[model samples]
Target: MALSPEDKEEYDEQRFAWIGADTVLATKDSDQIDKHLRIIQARVRTKSATAHRAFAISGRAGLGKSTTALTLGKKHERQRRKLLGDGPEVTPVVYAVVPPGATPKMLMRAFATWLDMQVPQRLDAPSITDQVVRVLAQQKTTLVILDEVHNLRTTRSAGAEAASQLKVFTERVDAAFVYCGIDLLTSDLFTGDIGKQVRARTKMYALEPYALGSARDREEWLELVLGMEDLLPLANHPEGSLEDEAAYLYHRTGGSIGSLRGLLGDAAIEAILTGKERVDRALMDDIILDEEAVRHAQESTAPSPTHSRAKKTG
Candidate 1:
C-alpha cells in the first residue's frame, strides 16, 4: 500500500527524530564506566571528602567516549532526582565540554553556561572559577563530566591555568569528576607536573573499537548490531537482518559504536524516505560515513604482510 504525501512527511519526521536520538549500547566499555560511576556515587553518598578520584575515558574518535560518559551522567542525575526529587537546586551532575583552545575563564564559562549562570565579561578567570565552584557546590553537584578534555592542554599558559582550575574545582566542589577525550593517554594534556597530578588523581579507562577477530568479539559486535536494529522504526525491517550483515556493518563502521550509529541511522532514514522501509547492504552502501571510520574500514580491509603470510601458509 502506497502512503499519501502527508503521511510520508509525518513518517519521515518521526524516523528522523528516532534516528537522531541514538540508542545507548550496553557494551563492555559502557558497563565498566557505569560500574565506576556507581562507585563514585556511593562515595558521594557516604560524604567521602577525601575521595576526590576522577574517572577518565579516553580513546579514538567515534568510540562512544562522550556518549558513555553523558549517558552515565544522566543516569546518575535521574537516580539523584529519584532520591531527592526534581528540584532546580538539586543538580547532581554538571556536564560541560572543554572548548578548543580553552582558557581558565573559558572553562569556567562553560560550566557557568551549563548551569545557566550569567558571568560578566569583566570578571577575571579566578573570579569566574570561584563563582562556578560556589554554584556547583551550592547545587550539590555530585558528578562532573568534562567532555573533550583533550582540548585542555597543559603545554600552553592559558591551558595550563585551565588545567589547574579544573584541579581546584575537583578539590573544592566535592564531586566525582569524569573526563572524556580522544587518545588522551598519548595526548600531551598530561605532561609535566600538572600531568602527574591528573594521572595520580584519575583512573583511566580506554574505550576501544570493537574487534571481530575472536568468537567473543564477533558475538559482542553482533549483539550490538541486534540491539540497534531493534530500535529502528521501519515497519518492514526484518528481525536479525542487521545481525546477518553484522560483518559487513563492522567492516563499514570499524566497530566504532558512534560510527555504527551514524551509518545505521542514516541508512534507516534513507530507507524510510525511499519507501524501502528496511536497511540492507544496498541502502547502506549509498551512505558515506565519517573520514575516520572510512579510513579505518579501508585499512582493515587492506591486505597486510601478516595476512599475506597466513594466507600463503594456509
Candidate 2:
C-alpha cells in the first residue's frame, strides 16, 4: 500500500537523522589499536604502581586516528562498566583533547573538564594538575586518551610545559595512556630530551591512507565501500550502487575514510532531499569535498611527466 505524502516526509526525516550520525566501521588499523589498548589495560591493572608503557597513533589528517582511539576508549569503558558495574564515579576511560596553544594549566583544565571537576580560576598549574591527578587515581581511570597531542609542541615554552605535565599525568595516574594526533612522529613533540623520554615509553602506530596499488588493496577498498553502503537508509537504492563505482570513489576520496564518509554522507543526504533515493557517479561528482581530498585526488589521477614524454616518443 502506498503511504500518504506526510507519512513519507516524516520517514525521510528519520532517515536523515540516522545518516547525520557518525558510523564507526571496524578496520584493520582499529583492530590493531584495540589489541594494543587491551594489553596496556591489563598491564596497568596488574602493576598499578609501576609506570607502564603507552602508545601513540600518528597519521595525516582524515585517516581516522582520533575516531579510532575514541572508539576504542568507549569500548574499554563499556567493558569496565560490565565488570565493575556502572557507578557514577567508576570512570575507566578519561578522554580529552589538547587545546590549541595549550599551556600547562590549560592542558590540566582540559582533563579536569572531562572529569567534570571544577577548578577555581585562582588555582595555579600545580594545584590544577594535583587535583586532576588525585581524581583520576581515585576514580581508578584505567585509560587516558589525549587526542590532538600534536598541539603540545615541545619547542615553545608553554607547549613544552604542557608536554611535561602530560608525562607527569602518565606517571601519577595509574591509567594506560593513548595519544592520537596528526603527523606526531615528525612534529616537535618528539624532538628534545623530553621527547626521548616519551619516545622510549610509547609505541607508535602509524595509520596510512588506503591505496589501490594491489589486488588485496582493491579487495579491502571494496569491502569498506560495501560496509558503508550497507548503512545507507535509502529505500529504493540498489544493493551495489557504491560498489559499482569503487574505482571512481577511490580516485575521488584518495582512500581516506574520513573523506569518503564526508563525500558519501553529503551525497546520501542530497539523494534523500532530491528524491533520487540512490547514489551514483553523477550525484557524487556534484558534491564538493574537502580541499585536501580534492587535491590528493587530482594529484593521484594526473599523468606523470615521464609518461607524457614516453607517449610522445611512442
Candidate 3:
C-alpha cells in the first residue's frame, strides 16, 4: 500500500529510531539465537559452573547473522534478572564484533570493555587472557557472542596459529562462546587437526535467506520481506498492476527477503519519477542495469562492513 501522509510521518520516526539501532528485535527469525539464550538461562538457574557452550550462527551476506547473534546476547541479558540474589550481579550477556586483523589481545580489550572491566588500552595476549578470565568469573557472564569470528582465523600470519589460538581459548575459557560468520568459517576453523580438537567445543549454525518456491506464498510473505512494497516509496499504481509487478519482483529478487524490498523500493522511485501506472520490469532493470549496479549499490549499504572509506584509499 502507498504510504499515507500520516504513514510517512510514522515511517520517518521509526526509521530515525533505527538509525543507530545496535540491539536485536525479538522475532521468529532469531529463534536460533533464542534457543542458545534459553540454554544459558537454564544453565544459570541450575547453578552449575560448567563450561559454556559454543553457539554458531552461520549465514550468507545480508542474512542478519550478526544481528541474530547480538539478539541472542540481548536475550541472555534478559534471562539474567532472577540471578540478582546470587552475589554481586551484572548483565550476563556480553556482545562483541570481531573485526578483521583482531588478535587475542584485541579480542580481550573489546571483551573487557563490554564486560565493564577496568582494562587498559593495550595488553599482551596472556595478560588480556588473565583479565578476561577474571572478569568473566567475576561478572558471571552467561554468554559471550563474538560476531564475525571468521576474521580471527585471518588474523594470524599462519593459519595454524589462528586455529590453535581459537582452540586454546575455548579450552581454557569457561564462558559460552558464540561464533557468527558466513559459510567459510566452518572450513577455516574446522579442517585441520586443531579444528578436530576444537570442533566439539564449538557449535555451528547458518541463517538462510528467505525463499518462496512459487507465487502462492508471495503475497503473504511480502509483508515479512525486508525491502518489499509496503516500505517502498512508490506512487500509486492504478488498478491491478501492483500484483503483477509483485510477481516480477519475486522472479528478480530470487525471493530473497533483503533483495526483494530493495528491488521494490528502487522500482517505486522509478515509477514515481516516470509517472507510471505500475512498477514494471523495465523500471526494475533500471535500478542498476547490470552486475556492477548490484556490486556498487547493494553491498555498500550494509550496516556493518569490515571496512568502509567513502573517499579514495591508497
Error of 3 at 175 (Å): 3.1
Residue runs of model 1 more than 4 Å from their true location after superposition = 1-11, 44-51, 305-314
True lDDT of residue 258, candidate 1: 92
Clashing pairs in 1: none
**Tens-digit lDDT track for model 1 on 1-314?**
57798987886897799789846556757777888777865675665556377889998998888778877877788888999889788889888999999998899899999999989999988898888889987888888989999998788898998998888777777778899998887765766888987888778899888998999999989988898888888989989887779989898888999999999899998888887999998889889899888888877767686665322110
In terms of TM-score, which candidate is strongest?
A: 1
Which ranking of candidates, highest TM-score first? 1, 2, 3
Residue 252 of model 1, lDDT score: 86
All-Cα superposition RMSD per candidate: 3.4, 3.6, 9.9
Better of 2 and 3 by TM-score: 2
lDDT of 3 by residue, 1-314 (tens): 47797986686555434432443433336765676656754554454444445667776665567666676666556667565544455657677766567666666677777777776666676687787777776777767777776666643454455455555665565567777776745546655565665566556666665445656465445545432333444445543445555545544554444455455555665565455725666776777433433443444344455557453210
Tens-digit per-residue lDDT, 148-260, candidate 2: 99888788999998888888778877788999899988877877888888888888999998888999999888988888888888867899878778888888888888888
My TM-score estimates for the predictions, one after another, are 0.89, 0.88, 0.63
Local lDDT at 49 for model 2: 57
> Candidate 1 has what TM-score?
0.89
Error of 1 at 234 (Å): 2.3
Q: TM-score winner between 1 and 2, please give it.
A: 1
